[model samples]
Target: MQLPLPPSPMALPLSGRFPAPFLPPSMRKAGLLHPIASASLSPTIKDETIDWVEATSNFFEKDTRPIMLFDGVCNLCNGGVRFVRANDRNRRIRLEALQSDAGKKLLRRSGRAPDDISSVVLVEKDRSYIKSEAVLRIMEYLELPFPQLALFLQFVPLFVRNIVYDNIADNRYTLFGRSESCEI
Candidate 1:
């Protein structure tokens, strides 16, 4: 649901080893896209469109921290969050249950349906990725050998990756077993 808006004036430069560009124009225009931005921004939808920068810039000003939003009640998702928390050695990642207020707000800001909880979302500076894209983004940030694997997977077509991701998501609850509470 991300808007196809024109580029902004203050777009930031992309960085890091992850091939993904920093603040792609789409993300930059949509707002909520800064490497060190805040995730507390709340966007208002109006006239069948969002105010974009006005609604997002206030919340993400100077903060580009990535927000990881996952399905709260899904055991598989919870485990994934736990794994991220434990292995993100520098504590570079921030997490939220998709059912939480913050997470919903982020989803909306990213122009995604807030109710769609099947996908894991990675909110990076100026861009948001879901499903297989989100997975690859997370993997790209991981330490060493894993990043290598992510790089290898990047060569596959996106549709193929999404199909694989969809299969796993479709059966994760049955395979992993859901818990009464999301403990991640």
Candidate 2:
């Protein structure tokens, strides 16, 4: 039996596949051509701000660069970390397994559940981004196509982006398999 598909940004043309800004104004306004919401027409960085006040108040005790805190035991999370490590030539993207002391501190500071392996966290001095926003923002550290792709995905709303992230996260262990530790 064919299972019903989940409602996704893919349903909104010029969104899931190609970058929306690439579409001509004529195509975008056509509505028939681009099924995206009008609000998405304008640039909006839909990053969720996590409160790190309590966590970083004194424990961290210093201005830290952007840190990518991930599920140390999740294979999928490890693979992503490796990919970023390789592509992030400058090493601007720092990684910390949520299973680590530093990672736990950052998560608690950001008011995130340390056990929530389903969501990845990107912590910066000013703010933190979780879930899909973390993934896309991390892409900016890479050269070429990755940042470009992130630019396109940024236009899509967080709710729309989360659908895909949540689906994969829900079945990550089953699909990519899991390990006891994703430490690098």
Candidate 3:
């Protein structure tokens, strides 16, 4: 008589491969094993801690600019920066690549992770905004018809607006193409 075959390897010790209930609490809390956590934990910068004096000093010393932070490697982003500069006419807006050291510092000081910032960032003395909010805030600072666009914020829901913004951002390279170099 043939003996019964043992259970397949896949059927044995399922918990060994996939410990649904035995995973460490820290791993579960982090959602994933992030490199930042592995390195060292430090106090995150608070919005109230932004040094306006330092930011303004850097802006003046670097280029006497307003410090617009954008994706340094994105072609569409570079073009958009140029467009904003051209439209400003007054030349009030200054630019910096998010990849730059200064940009990273500012982001950190603002309680944001540089790697996680995918949209344009406009930082002022003590405040910051992201995505569509950043765009609208910039327009408001332009001090003219651009400020009128801020009215759109009232009519559009934040969730709906972010969806459109995120879609464009996700496909910007494919739709608008990319640049070989990061332009200021």
Each candidate: how many clashes? 7, 2, 1
Give each model a TM-score.
0.70, 0.66, 0.63
Q: What's the CA error at residue 149 for candidate 2, in Å?
A: 0.8
Query: Distance from true position, residue 10, model 3, in Å?
Result: 46
In terms of TM-score, the best-performing candidate is: 1
- Could you tell me which residue pairs clash in candidate 3? 66-94
How much lDDT does each candidate structure score? 0.68, 0.67, 0.63
- Least lDDT summed over 10 consecutive residues: which range in candidate 2? 9-18
Question: 60-159 in candidate 3: lDDT tens per residue?
Answer: 5645445678887888898878778767887777787888888876665444564645788776654556787777767776756777878767479767
Off by over 4 Å in 3: 1-66
lDDT score, candidate 3, position 169: 92
* Model 1 C-alpha lDDT per residue in residues 43-118, reported as the tens digit of each score: 3222225433245454467766788889999988988888887768877777888888777767665655567687
The reply for model 1, stretches above 4 Å from the true place, is 1-59
Candidate 2 global TM-score: 0.66
lDDT of 3 at 116: 49
Q: In model 2, what are the clashing residue pairs, if there are any?
A: 55-109, 72-182
User: What ranking of all candidate models by lDDT puts the best one first?
Assistant: 1, 2, 3
Winner on TM-score (1 vs 2): 1
Name the TM-score of candidate 3: 0.63
